[model samples]
Target: MAETGEGSRPGYSSAVELRGVGHGKREHAAASPPPPATDAAVLHSSVLDTIGEEITGDALPEGHVLTLEQIRERFGVSRTVARETMRILESMGLVRSRRRVGITVQPRASWNVYDPRVIWWRLSGPGRNAQLRSLTELRIAVEPLAAGAAARSASAAERERAVGIAATLRALGEAGDLDRFLEADIAFHTLLLQASGNEMFGALADVVAVVLQGRTQLGLMPHHPEPAALDLHEAVADAVAGGRPRDAETGMRELLAEVRHAMLPLWEPRTRKG
Candidate 1:
């Protein structure tokens, strides 16, 4: 199993299983608030929301660069907090500060689309059709290939497990049990990646988990998948288990195309706010 990188999505190399979409763990422990860090910092959600709205909400106003002092005063935080907040913003690719100039907003293109934090932030808005499309696109690009490779490489036991998981997912869907269905879905995909016998590809289990997490967060999976969707995974697993790489690839591709179509209805209304 690959050791997850510092910012890697969570569950990258573990088989313990994840409940929802996306990898990466967040610390949200509830503790009594301590004295403010002397350095300018704003730790409240209100401040983070304000900053996100400022950058992504509108076109930059004339000479819209924000000085550290300005952020501190605007949010009523110590300079240290403001500075730390700026660092956070920079990590999100929301702003850039040069030696001479203060923090200047970066174009949306600079944002880390793959970073779980940014994706979560974006999903907090009114709609998440774009995010959904992007995630599924990521799945389409990587999963089919993984399925083909799994067909060629999986150990006998791993192949059997993959087939079993696929059957379980189908049964869960048939029972209209979304919660268990999602669990089986995660396991089904994770098995495919693990069975591929390529560490780089196997590492993508986190990515798959993340995608499922995002969808579940947005209420997209429905109470049960369409029956056709339910059958898709089984077909892929069956092809792979039978050592039919080409068939596995074809089945996976078809499954992805169906997912893409299911997602189109959600992305139809544009949400690009300038």
Candidate 2:
């Protein structure tokens, strides 16, 4: 596991200091009501996100002990907030709390890697390259199969939507609209999985979205997506729309292979370092 960086607990500035007000004004403000109930939820989420990132980034390695008291003290949060954070993390398989032994950070193997939130945290951390590589491999394995299935079995409306998304992807990629391109790219891939009519494959939509966004965020995407890649995407959409299973599979495989090759240089060094 690679340590990304130090994780600091969230904090709030004193309202008086934040406002840079006179003593009388400070006293008045202090007498006012505190923030709304939603602020507490925000605080809980902030603590949960910070601790989750630390664990996934290896800042808090497996077997490290934690406790509600420790979380409350470190983050200046209430015991309720800390307990809720722990409960969320436990549900995500990032930690395990025992009555007497305290909370221990779980091994990475225990994590719900397929969870979109987990994938997002990993992508935002130092281990992003590894996560991207893993996702790419997963996409390579399943996407072509999904494309083939979609071509054979998808409803007409699904096929039409897939084609429309691919067209949008091509337009966005060509215009160097990275944000929209990534969005369209995710939509195209996710639609393929869902249109395949396989429940298991459909559930991977979030996984594909994370991978697509991660690559763009990490600056792994080219300034302009290669013409060949764009062409393959169009080909895949056409084939699926035309109910050509073989062509859909072949085109999707080629597109994925090209993406993998393009990303190899970015991922190889990280692999060696790990």
Candidate 3:
């Protein structure tokens, strides 16, 4: 589901595992006392993301790499903060570091391109054209199959929820309420994935959320869902409700293709041109 990297780096995966566990605890502890609200941790992540945006915009190409010292100076954050930020970037496949090599910008193809966080970082500017393109590629691969599974497996209630989400998205799209549209989009996708009855599939909900956020920020997709797009989403839900797996798969494929087409115009020549 979530690809981290080569597994060569010590403690590379610990942070992600910790984050996932924290997320699960948050989800399950609905009635439990809240944890220390570390707004700064989130802010740290945001600042690191901004650093990524800068890298994407200017420093990454022609091998103008960065060091922890430089990063600390550039961001004016503590060495620990800068280190953690680079760890975040490394996890997203934006940077690679070794015991001695320090850090280097990995090529676009090397990125964990499907991670929503990475996608958001890319959508922050011109540097992420490759990242956006890779994200679409992952969508093309995973979504149609997920749709088919949903078609074959979704319960009646799940199907209804999917359809309702799509419909609401359509209305929001028509109103140009991009924020609401993205929310509905996430709900629609989460319903479909959850309907698959695969826990791993369900885990992608966060990734989907990130992708929607990134696309919205990039101004590629509408703030609101397009009516036609909404209709296609509905068609998929209907197929899933009817247990027509092939139909659902085809419907989802078409819908994703349409979105990709819409996004192609927004992508820069480096990413969009064949």
Q: Pick the candidate with the highest lDDT.
A: 2
- How displaced is residue 178 in candidate 1, in Å? 0.9
- Say which candidate scores most in TM-score: 2
Inter-residue clash pairs, candidate 2:
none
> What's model 3's overall lDDT?
0.65
Residues 51-92 of candidate 1 have per-residue lDDT tens digits of 764564454533369888898898898788787777877887
Task: Give me the runs in candidate 2 sitting further than 4 Å from their true place.
Answer: 1-40, 270-274
Q: Whose lDDT is higher: candidate 1's or candidate 3's?
A: 1
Q: CA lDDT of each candidate?
A: 0.67, 0.77, 0.65
- Between prediction 1 and prediction 3, the one with superior TM-score is 1
lDDT of 3 at 68: 91
My TM-score estimates for the predictions, one after another, are 0.71, 0.80, 0.66
Consecutive 10-residue window with the lowest summed lDDT within model 2? 15-24
Candidate 2 structure quality by residue, lDDT tens digits, 1-274: 3343323322222222222111112223312323422234578777877888889886999999998899999999989889988998999899999998899999888999876567767776777788889989999999999999999998888788778877887888889998777756776887788789897887776677667755776678999988888899999999999999999999999999988987898777765233
lDDT of 3 at 74: 77
Go through the candidates in order and give the clash count of each: 17, 0, 3
Per-residue alpha-carbon lDDT of model 3 for 27-142, expressed as tens digits? 22212222433335655655665666656555465245778988888767788988888888888777887776678887767777555455544555554556566667677777
Q: How close is candidate 3 to the true structure, as a TM-score?
A: 0.66
